[model samples]
Target: MNFIPQFTQRSAGTEAVVSLPHGGRRPGRELLVRALIGLAILLVITLLVWFDRDAYSDSGGDGLTFVDALYYATVTASTTGYGDITPVTPGARLINALVITPMRIAFLVLLVGTTLEVLSNEVRRVLIDRRWRKRMRNHVVIVGYGVKGRSAVNTLHQQGHDLNRMVVIDNRPASVDEANLTGVAAIHGDATRREVLRRAEISKAREVIVTLDRDDSAILVTLTVRQLNPSAHIVVGGREGENVSLLRQSGADAVVTSSDAVGRLLGLSAVSPNIGAAIEDILSSGVGLEVAERQVTANEVGNSPADIRGERVVAVVRNKTMRRFYDQSVDTLQTGDNVVVIRKSEARAEKERSERD
Candidate 1:
């Protein structure tokens, strides 16, 4: 099985936290249903008294009407009796003692349901926050769930990374809602702020990605994340080529200039159709060809990159160092070398099994 980290995010002061929708009615709906049931109880009592009008007396020394019965039922069910109406016969007294009293208790319980639900929401929030924080060690936090952020996560997920270990941080409510809809936790806050990063547990994160719209904001967030997690692998998205060095200096491990990358693709498409098509195929994930990294197995040791049967190996990583496939230093694949290869997405399972082989 592939073991990948999970995801989580928290906003300032634990205010904007929501997980995937679980089974339950909405609080408003629940309250409405309970109110209807309480009303039903009150109506039943009112009808019983109204049908036997001679059994009840009014303070005005007049025959009891349906309105008087309703008033009596309302006051009695609410436990706010005004002593203006009283049961005059054994039948009315008996029904009040046996039926109305128990339903009065039910009515009160339904009213209390509203208060209980409010308290339950607060308690549930606390428990969920605690559980999430407890399981958040060494996870990935992707700040700013824009196009870049979505692409990065899509690549990771297609390559068998765990979506549960992915947390999205965005200042937009819509972005946060989208993350939750996709089953990824989200934090709604400014990524450049210290408290926001702390809320995401940045210090414990293994990887952080900054994909903010503004290059300046991305740089600031990268610096803040780096200061918080000196050992984390932070990848940033840059809008302009000029800010590449500034982003790197801000502590981004790698920076992708989106505009330049797109511009090059556009140029390639105009100049050479075949080259552009091949590049697009490699970039697209979860279908057709995909780029992935896997561990070298016992079956493939001491073999050159060209010897791999299923996938084409492009680079080899050994001892924390990467060597190009053409580099003679990595001609023989070592037992623990990690190879970056291009393989069929549909055959991903076969490729993963190759690691064990």
Candidate 2:
């Protein structure tokens, strides 16, 4: 399915702009500015004609009053030319031809220009939306753009994930604008709705990340997404451990319970700060140390886990099954074994050294 992302509001560069459906907010401001300027011009001309009342003839009434000048200005600018008021003197005729006539034309142009600009913008928005949706496929759909969602996307970006292939769905206008600013496609709507998921092309998505603020909302979103795309990998974040089971039953492939994970970290910190620190270093990206996985080296293929050098080998994978270093079968590494190790993250090596000093 193609993902047609509608841009409700987006800020462009240095300008603070807010666009909306049908007619944008910023364009309305522009129209207001134009209207004010046109009114100012009309006022100035009305004063000029009123001050020189002797230069004109009002056949139906006495010499022109302030009210007549106002009425004449309106009818003249609108090209009504009622003919009751005529410029009898050469000075009045010259002023009407040189000054008043031009301002009248300008007033009409500004009104017509505003209409044309709106039409032009609508066409442009539609074309760009169509083009974006056509190229979307096998992308990643993020249901929320909150703290956890930002972290997840940042980590994926560090791993060289494509931002263009990711779509962010958030109900908050600010969140959607932020996502667009960061060069990601975003949809501003409730993600739990089936139509919204379909617009995000959930059927063709490779993965879906649910990080809503509430567990109940997350569960509803997970169930909806799973029903839409059963084959896609869905990773959900639950604030409480008790909600993890519900999220799993809702069809989330993996559920990360933030409360439980943080509690465990706190417990480990109280017992052994060094162990907790080490675990944190491994979990952190582009910092101190990191956990990485690699295929067994040629020379290390026939060697035992204890014989490997440089990095600490934590586990080995063979035939899709994981075996820890303490496991009997993992003592001997095989040809196709993949090793998971704790090593200094090469990407953050320089930054880490600088910060330590």
Candidate 3:
């Protein structure tokens, strides 16, 4: 099914910018700058004609004064030559032909350019949005851009995920601005609302991360997203461990207890520093060690997990069910199975390539 995103204003008052399309100047500011430039052009003409007042005549049968010079400049630059004031000298006429004409042309171009930009702004945004939407399948939708959301994005980025495939939704304008500054699309609205989720294309997203500050909000957003996209993998962050099951039952594929995780790590660090540090290193992405999942290769099929070189197989996933390496159901590697392994982040591919060679 093809869905086209339309950014319609839902309010009666001044609307906030929907998207920072090109991250360039605001339309109002751009028009103001162009107007200033047009005025500068007019000022130059006025000064030029004023300095050469001797070479000009006025319709009142008097010498050309500063007011007459200004009047002539206004009419001439606008291409509305009233002929009330005429340049009589050969030098003045030459200056008009060479300098004034070009300035007049430049002024017209600026005027036309400003009009075109204003007229084409909507069209440009629509075209860009169409193109972006067409390529946005299986993208990630982040419900919040707070600390957890930012850390999830940073971790994904470290694991070589494309930042362009991410979209952030935040109720705070500051979070939206910060998200845009990172080159990712952001929508400013309540993520728990269905309309806001539709704007983020949540139905087509492969993964939805709900990291709202409140656990109840996260559960609500998670439920809403699951209703919109049942197939998407939803990971939620809960403030307390007691609400973890509630978040999961709300259709989250995984739930992490923020306080419990931190508390356990701190306690482990006090008891066994080295083991705690190692666990932290593995949890932190793109570092000394990493945990990742991959499909079992043909060569590894029918062999024992210990025979696989370079990677330590921790679990085998079959039919979406995970089994530890010591499980009897997965003693022998199978063709259509995925293996979760722990390996050196920097040398993961190098070790596998060496094994193949």
The list of candidate 3 runs beyond 4 A from truth reads 1-33, 53-72, 81-90, 158-160, 171-183, 303-307, 326-328, 347-357
The better candidate by lDDT, 2 or 3, is 3
Error of 3 at 228 (Å): 1.1
Question: Which residue pairs does candidate 2 place in steric collision?
Answer: none
For model 3, how does the per-residue alpha-carbon lDDT over 17-47 read when each residue is reduced to its tens digit?
A: 2443234555667779999999999989999
The 0-to-1 C-alpha lDDT of every candidate, in the order given, reads: 0.82, 0.82, 0.82
lDDT digits (tens) for residues 25-48 of candidate 1: 545576688788888999999998
Better of 1 and 2 by lDDT: 1
Clashing pairs in 3: none
RMSD of each: 5.1, 6.0, 4.9
| TM-score for each predicted model, relative to the true structure | 0.78, 0.77, 0.79
| Runs of candidate 1 exceeding 4 Å displacement | 1-21, 26-74, 86-103, 347-357
**TM-score, ranked from best to worst:** 3, 1, 2
lDDT at residue 197 of model 2 (Cα atoms): 81
Q: Where is the poorest 10-residue window by lDDT in model 3?
A: 1-10
What local lDDT does model 2 show for residue 273? Answer: 100
